[model samples]
Target: MSVLIKSSLARKIVMALSGLFLVFFLGQHFIINITSVIAPETFNLWSHFMGYNPLVQYALQPVLIAGVIIHFVMGFVLEIQNNKARGLSYVKYKGGANASWVSRNMIISGAVILAFLGLHFYDFWLPEIAYKYIENNPEDATRYHAETVHKFEAIWRTVLYIISFALLALHLLHGFASSFQTMGINNKYSSAIKTFTKIYAIAIPLGFIFIAIYHHLNPITH
Candidate 1:
């Protein structure tokens, strides 16, 4: 394990795999979250199950957190190592001559996304933990939808969500295609894969933005 982390190639592979895993989780989360806007009852049912499921709460949640840590930490390590290896030559390097703006500034986009994740965890995860574990409150299966809607009641939060998701789109624009490349998936399907990734990069963030705006405009006023 230590030896694998020491190898640059191995580190890239690990980062790529972890990133792809998070992409899958993101898709699943989006699907569930979208239901909150369309079908409140369904959203409540699914949220209740996810919140109480031992497999998710105990096993998958920890693994997901670890994957996020590994990907971000490895990204920072690789960026630093790349900069060091480039040294003085990096000063003369013209990023635009070869790479796209999105590719060149992944670190900036990634940092924004990391900050957004912190906010997301604080808004949702911490409260959920307090409700279920620390406070030992009984589960209320029907409460999820109202809680989700209430979070978007503030315009500031809605705007921040849109901004964060915009940066997330930027991050995915390059990261998604690069993950496949890092995994050495260079076959005839590569073009199709890139096309799908581009759509996903744009669509998922837009979907999240829509969700935020939808709830903000249509608040649960009871």
Candidate 2:
């Protein structure tokens, strides 16, 4: 176990596994978030459950954070190691001929995605924490929908969210297929995997973007 941990392949394996975990999270999160547009009451109920459930709060939340941090840190490390090994940027490069733009620029997209996540935490997560822990706000699930609508009222915030989701789609387009490749799943089903990855990448992010836009435009008309 220690020997595997010391290997380069092991680091790649960890990054791939973490990336896959995040992919699963994205699907779940997108489904839950999109509920705001389709079914408000159900959305609130689920949001309350997620926020207040002891097991999710204590165990799953921490695991999710660790997975994200490990993936982010390992990605940066791998990029740095690869660059150092190359010793110089490619001259007369034709990487674009073989690889997609997202594949070639994984590190850049990953960095931007990380920045976008920070903004998300600032916009929603931090306030939630402060409300729950610091200000001692009531543990009321009914208020979540109103809070969500109010935040998207700002055009600029909505725009930033759309942009981030677009970039996230690009990031996932590469990441989903690449993680499978890293796990040695490249075989006759590779084409199918790529097809599924592309669809998921576009659909999930677009779903979130639509949610932001919908809330922003149709803000709780009473």
Model 2 TM-score, 2 decimals? 0.92
* Model 1 agreement with the true structure over 56-102: per-residue lDDT tens digits: 99999999999999999988887776676666333345675678777
Off by over 4 Å in 1: 1-6, 88-93
Please give the distance, in angstroms, between residue 155's alpha carbon in candidate 2 and its true position after superposition.
1.1
**Per-residue lDDT of candidate 2, residues 11-117 (tens digit):** 78899999999999999998888889899998899999999998998999999999999999998887766566566533323475667667767888888889888
CA-RMSD of model 2 = 2.9
Candidate 1: worst 10 consecutive residues by lDDT? 84-93
Q: Give the Cα-based TM-score of candidate 1 against the true structure.
A: 0.94
Candidate 1: Cα lDDT at 2:
57
Candidate maximizing TM-score: 1
